[model samples]
Target: TVPGIGPVYTAGIVAEIGDISRFKNHNALAKFAGLTWRQHQSSKFSAEDIPLTRSGNYYLRYYLIEAA
Candidate 1:
């Protein structure tokens, strides 16, 4: 069970909520992977270049990354 994945990769996967389908497209997925440019605005709201949405399953993400 141990010595499977590392931390960063695990965190990245966990940060992604649901299946890859949840992403509108490949670009979206890449964005979540922090492999693309950061979005600073959404319509009328402005956001920072922070990581994935914290509203996501944090425990899962943390554990994922930890395991990774």
Candidate 2:
């Protein structure tokens, strides 16, 4: 989810950020990969409280989804 990150580079990052727990929480880890929330809960988004900008680590998400 790193903005402007290339595939090769992303692979390296995933290799390095092995123990993601090194980050405090999901939000903190999400921010590291530039995957944070955006947008506001306006009248249109009232149904949804918070919306995250797809800025989370895609690799992490992918692996978890696959493993699950």
For each predicted model, how many residue pairs clash, with residues at least 3 apart or on different chains? 4, 2
Report lDDT (CA) for all predictions.
0.58, 0.63
Candidate 1: where is the Cα deviation over 4 Å? 1-17, 38-68
Measure candidate 1: CA RMSD.
7.3
**Predicted candidate 1 versus true structure: per-residue lDDT over 1-68, tens digit per residue:** 24876665565555555576788987665545444444578789987555554443455545555665
Q: Which ten residues in a row have the lowest lDDT in candidate 1?
A: 52-61
- List ranges where model 2 is wrong by over 4 Å: 1-16, 19-21, 30-39, 43-45, 49-52
> What's the TM-score of each model vs. the native?
0.31, 0.37
For candidate 1, the TM-score is 0.31
